[model samples]
Target chain A: MQAKKLKYKEYLEKYKNCPTSDFIEVERDAFRWTGTDVSLEDFIPVNIKRKPPARILDDSDKMCMAYGLSMFDTLNNALKKYFKLYKKQRIHQQEHFKQDKGTKIAMINLTKNDGIADLPNKNNFGHFTFHEYKETNLVGKISDLYSVFKSNGDFNI
Target chain B: METLIFNSERKLKTENFARIGDLSYFEGPLLSLFEDLTNGNFYFFDWVDRDQDYNRWIIYRVLPKHLLNFLNRKISHLDLFRQRPEKSVYFTDIDFENKGYFYYSAYEIESFPKNYFPNEDSYFDPEDCNSIDRIKSIIFNSFARQKSENEYSKVYHIHNLKTKTNYCNQPIGRRSKRTTSVNKLFKAIKFEDLKNSPSFDYYSKEIKLYPDLRNPVQANIKEDENKYS
Candidate 1:
């Protein structure tokens, strides 16, 4: 019923510092005010070689590393993929939202196709979703997003 | 366990990930990364057969505490840690940047793209492999091969937030959007601090930090399961 306490002196000398230690760390990718926060390793811990899971705080609830979305390249890559498929489709994106339960779910205008296919607004026009992440069943996907505006109340869009 | 001595004598900690923990609880309250009692992996799932009692979730094993604090300092004042392989890792006394700016979603001091570190390829084609199984295998292998070292860690991208879309090869900040992307944010962090600081504030991590991995239920390990098994 009791776990073992970690002895610090054991691996202190082996800490890969410099470039290795200098690498930025943070919460998982899925953590969100609107959605879930994902870890470097999906779940199989042994798979986190170079990623080395982020550090936990004193309380263990707070994230040590930081989070930033790679929008430019992401959008660029998405557009490139869309173009490679359609060849001549104009692309566009508009963010929309609604309050449900308590979180905000921003719905992107997917005017043409799922963007995975191709058409107008096809550059990187895939749908955007927000949701919470699960830990046991290996379930991760779109759900909802958080909004500055109150949910189920006065909204601008 | 002379793990360090053994590693120096002969490296055993392969780049593959190690098991941090498991998921037996799921009642639902959006768990924060460092919360005392939250799920390890932060994703959502539903049973193909709802009545079949099958649900899949993710679990994250929290790494050493000092690692987390170090990462926080790096990202919060990202400009400081924005060095290539040529720089040294040390804390500085330079005033940290705290300009309040919300780029992509959260409020970040600086936006990305200004300091984007381009990888060989930004997007990964699932079709690169002959079949879906091959793609999954590629993902599994890479995940297994990745190093826990911080340097290589930069190229890897995984999220705990709500966005389910797979980022693939695209590093953060490849876009010119507000900032918040990975590449740009890390690029913008104030590396100058480490280069020029009077007080070694960030350097003394071990002395100043309380290495507690029991972070309630929040987020974020290295490898070494095979040999032990």
Candidate 2:
């Protein structure tokens, strides 16, 4: 087993200080390293310039003018709601993954073996099958599967 | 636009100004501000005009409500743009300690006449003077309303970024260094240096940028549907 320590502190700082553009780069890197194939659009919407969505509140208070609310208050409220929604979504995803424990454990075990030929059978893995593994490298795929299985515990095989 | 037009009547082309295109891309990133606000952290914003290397520091207080409507529907996530009167429409720049800072209020800036002293305007033109006076009233009344609604509001705590000796709010140091966050905002921008460029830089704090909304996938259906209906 690889003793992989997540760069929580580094990534957290990047998340905090990096603007959406540079943040997307970091995001892409993180996804690549973690075997997350999420489209960049899914995480952050882009503009006409194909630039990532994120803005700096300037001295003009442009945001306040457009929306007719204090930039401070609007951002304050929006952020609270966004985080609340984000937290709720995360929990919902976690709960969903938990419900399919049998499938998850089987997938994790099957993924531990290398190559499509090595995978046991379709009945054991269900929808998260060999096709899903193609997008990620064998090592990253196994690590992702292992993390999920490890965090939630191995289900009855 | 307000930053450049300081008591000037000359026509300023879009080329004269640096634009910070659609700021809606920032809504997601600036969400972090909410956490900072709740934790009692006072915020001060700095605007840097990349072309001229100019900087404006802003410190502001939250606005007082003009009229509290109990029956009004609470704003939904997608319905952020629905306008309402008596809301906090601008940020007033205040001089806390004898320091003069250009405070840009959104409403005041928006109210500025599209043409200050149009060529058509002559001292003999009484109608033009009335139009100008109307513009003044709009700017004045906003300030007047703020003054009248004093007791209902609170002063925002401001942090001075400049040294006490340095009064003029200007760009810091030579060759402006981009902060990590600022750099990220511009990551995907492809710049072409054109002496006579046809496209002027478009500036807005809330325009949804990136992924080019023109693409079919990025088109916001709700906004389009509502507009057509």
Candidate 3:
């Protein structure tokens, strides 16, 4: 009559075997954000330039290095969750939280055509991930896929 | 045991110099040359996979500074050792293994010429009496290859040398791995090609030069209050 608590291994197995389709839906929105320290040129996918922090995911054996996004139904809900997680992580790391400057958030539309995949991770429930197999393929595709905007103002591109 | 004796004999035969625990010693211009080579540019490529587990390679474009850092612990990264890809080198990092043991392949782009010397003002030359033998002596004397994974292959281990105690906890063995990806990268890029390659410009171009005077999140809250009031 009581619910079972999942162990770490069981949790890993549950997510690993979880049906991919359950996590991602076509035409659903995914949100990703960059810190205020990042600039616009960081979004450029040139081989010589450093990638934007939002676009560069943590390296892991379980998953290929790719852009990490949180799937949410609305922009407001996504922003609230993003800030909450950001604050929690900063506090966990014993780092001081700095004032949000001109931070940028990108909203990406997931479609069957984009070749994106759902990788339900324990770190975040709504994690949607994608990666380009080749470096050259990423050069022009990044800017085209996501609609970016300033978090504070009406400025967007 | 036998390997250590052989190495000591080789050093003595070549350089006529032998020290008990000290690995190698250089003097004058040769010291500067050694410093330049050890601290120079290098490309590091590493990845982890379900099947392969962990793999890494250090490809020396000039010489390997990473190895020197590993030896001396000049820079410490707490638990993780991460090197991001730039114009010059590939990206790599190790998160799981905090055991203070590293296994990665290391390769020199191309072998230096037998006749090569640092400069015309050098004391010894191949054309002179103390020629190719002296230069070869320096190379062999400096890093003694103790254990060989293969009969023909050379494996240089610096475990016996006195190393500084640091956060990463002094990794013991720096062994080499033989993999197809390492060979491919070695063949694809050449030492001459990297001469004109773009240097790292991440700090200059990507980082914000100035912090914002006002917090955007706070300003957003104020805007919402104004609209409601």
Candidate 4:
């Protein structure tokens, strides 16, 4: 029994580096959603593995940490840029402090279903496809978008 | 809120107060067969394709901190509630036939030698079976009253340490006709929500029942002996 389980454990390692390729293909008039037909392609398999929550931190906690780290980096870079632009400004001045801290904004996703991919489907024509339909509300706050660099502006559609 | 897997028909056993159910999930036949082949590592539950003598609904019970870490470790995906388990329980239509014995693993396997699924049964100890009377007390807070068909018993929640905040009402995964964004399965419910929801109450302990649930025909003898019996 031990030997067999060991074999399975070895086998599972193959799935560890599961491929994360972009959609496989998009076919013309192959996928249907809400009365619209579209072609779709490329389906990346998300190999979900079970892990105890007590042993690992939750996703939300990790997301919050990422947000905080990015914000810190952003503040650091903004201060560096301000110092470079105004080299003659004294370190103690109120204007320098104001310049170091730039105005920033943040947007929170009110919809809880975040990071979902299009549904995978098989067409009658023997082709694989992915389908997507989205509706969400984004609530914005006059806070920070934490980053040491400029905002990417790569907004999710 | 935490996620739970239960046989819906088991919930109806409130009348008998004899046996409780084991936690079960569907797996591929090969994997299931492998587990069964192991030294009684897993107790066999019903095959998903059982005949529909009765509908054995495999419903997800979303509660805060009710599930064990061992069971939680088996949940590989967040979208489990959206997918139907393979081989749903089918029942025979005849009313008088005896079905079979229920068996399941009550213990969780934490660390194991590599190369196999990370689980071990608490053994085939029938004595470890749960008591319906205790479950009824936990659910309805009453000892012996039978639960009416439509009268939903107060669902019970265990305090899962993983969920400090409940998001059970929030939309999870995708939306469907029978499921609303707010009412979707796997959604977390806040502690306040768990406290306030009309459907559930909290329980603090576990109870065990001996022997297995089987037929013991006791006639009501209300009308006739030979005719009714």
Candidate 5:
């Protein structure tokens, strides 16, 4: 398990400096209710316990350990791919699970900068998917990432 | 004027709860269950979809402090069900025949209106009002028509005092009639109006069942029998 984990870390290290473009985090309607105002609380990692509440999607620890912010290259792509999967999941819920009416999808546009690019690697779908290492200061890492985007005014609807 | 002494207190057990997703909005069947339970009132919500052969219901009870903290965002959604103060919320899902699941949860209110003793009168009797058998009975009766006549049928029902809508399946021969009735009902009702209605009363005096988690089966055996029946 240790060797396998290191492999993932080595894979992430390879793309630490890769250049990337703006990506979108498909958000829930609950997060976007405030309209254009950027709530840093929304960006807080699920592992950390403070604040206005972490995103529910982050609860899936299997996806990405640190803070999995699943994103896509563009809003349309996210809608076409991610949201399509989400809608199908909703239908499945209607058939065999509890349907949550509030699971509506929305999007947030974020600019890729030095701070974000340094985090880890991007997937083929244009997501800056990263995992946390043992030595990483998770709270500080997330706060710094949020600051980089907030100060640069890179948050957009 | 009568002084009501709030004397009774009930706390939830630590190991009986389960966490779901966040509570985004403050209103819904789940939230309503929490509020009613917090105020010492009994409440339940149930639904069925014959097409999927699925059915579900939830009964709730809660502590006032926890509810207040939850509403104030003092308790993050992640920690909503975490054990605290030697007690935490309780939740369990008991499955039944025919793809049915009954969910029950509670953290008894800290106190009740002075001189008010909680009993069956606090809410309607569960056996008569909200029970797995009651829901099953509805489904059985609705589908019996199709089984006897050799026709296709579908049934769905969502029972809640707030929504006040009951939809049941009809035989294929009555499909058009059912569709017309459902369409008419949809056109007559406005979702905006339902959203605007006052659904909760924080100071409500009604008291609900204080579940004995240690012996849930003994406390509510009829509902528990769904495991076998």
Candidate 6:
């Protein structure tokens, strides 16, 4: 039998060295308590719970996103449903931002005294600083409903 | 009882999950054949006597598949339906990813006789006609009587998803007098209040005699266990 040499590209192309996959990053506002997104991945609803500070002067305060910390009891139970689906990976995360320019997600915190009117300062890259709110009738808010995901990071529930 | 056909569609927009169950709704040779296979298992009740029942048969199962399809090997739709039965039917798969939802489909066809269907006026029994919650009480009184003296692990779970209440408790084996008495102590309201009411039928023949049991062996009912739930 005559031996014929095979092209190097043919062997290399056929024998692919598989590369490791990357984690599927999930971004949520975490403020609206979007339990369904967490649920879609089999995490329990109780896990994504939120426990706002003793006195949240408005809806924006209770609505800030959570990064798997300080979840309410019921919310945590619901979050476990997702953690179970994703197997052992922690998928809960949020992008730290200062004002209205930040993407709307599941759990978001809005404790700014001036609201959107006080935004546009690019250097507001720290935690929220709430002074006494002089506005009246601006109470807190929370609801249980389906969330709609539009863009890569923007979410509403 | 009637033949509950699978709608064979996936993306069901309905708010409920339709499951396949008992075949006893259909009667005659077809039902008898299935009963022979399962050895008289109650779940095999099928299209033997269509004239017998009507109400429960009218409503059908929700499709787990969006649309049932097949290559037109033959001209007729029914032939294609039976040949490619699985494709003509669908099961819960892929789309559920990211959504924490699960699907339930029963292997048996429903055997609820049309005659067994409840009448608005009479309920199932004549005596308790005035009870306001007769419909509620009747459905709650369902039971999974032991197919055989030795057969365990058989359960009949009935829930009124509409009311969001699961009225029936499981494992309907014969209880000792002592066990019955103990259960009576803690129950806030007695089960008798619901059990004695009409509307619910325990899948029993009003005229037939009981199955012979003293001889220590698995009975005929447990053998042919392919009835709808």
lDDT for model 6, please. 0.22
Interface RMSD of 6: 28.3
List the global CA lDDT of all models: 0.22, 0.22, 0.26, 0.22, 0.27, 0.22
Clash number for each model: 111, 17, 0, 39, 5, 84
TM-score of chain A of each: 0.16, 0.15, 0.39, 0.16, 0.33, 0.18
For residues A42-89, what per-residue lDDT tens digits would candidate 4 score against the true structure?
Answer: 111111111101111112112111111011112333333333322222
- Assess candidate 3 and give its TM-score to the true structure: 0.24
Which runs in model 1 stand beyond 4 Å of their true positions? A1-127, A130-157, B1-11, B14-197, B205-229
The interface RMSD value for candidate 2 stands at: 21.0
Regions more than 4 Å wrong, model 5: A1-43, A55-66, A77-157, B1-8, B16-106, B109-229
C-alpha positional error of residue A140 in candidate 2 after TM-score superposition, expressed in Å: 9.0
Measured by TM-score, the strongest candidate is 3
Error of 6 at A31 (Å): 8.7
At residue A36, candidate 6 shows an lDDT of 37
lDDT for each residue of candidate 1 in B116-159, tens digit (9 for 90 to 100): 22121222222221233432332233333233332222222222
Name the 10 consecutive residues with the lowest summed lDDT in model 1 chain B. B43-52
Deviation of model 2 at A110, angstroms: 14
Residue ranges of candidate 3 with Cα displaced over 4 Å: A1-25, A35-62, A65-73, A89-102, A119-125, A131-157, B1-229
In the range B32-151, model 6's lDDT, one tens digit per residue, is: 101111212211111112211111112222111111121111222223223331222221211111121112222222333333221222111211112224322221222222333221
Compared with the true structure, the alpha-carbon lDDT of candidate 3 equals: 0.26
DockQ of each two-chain model: 0.02, 0.03, 0.01, 0.01, 0.02, 0.01
In candidate 6, residue A11 scores what lDDT?
Answer: 22
Tens digits of per-residue lDDT, candidate 5, B98-178, equal: 111122222343432222221211222121122334333323332432342221111111112123333222233433444
B-chain TM-score of model 2: 0.16
TM-score of 6: 0.16
Q: For residues B1-229, what per-residue lDDT tens digits would candidate 3 score against the true structure?
A: 0001111111101011111111111000111111111111222221111111221211112222333442243533111123322212211222233121122212222322212112222221111111233333433432432122221111001111112123123222211234323223323433334234441121122112112212542344344222211
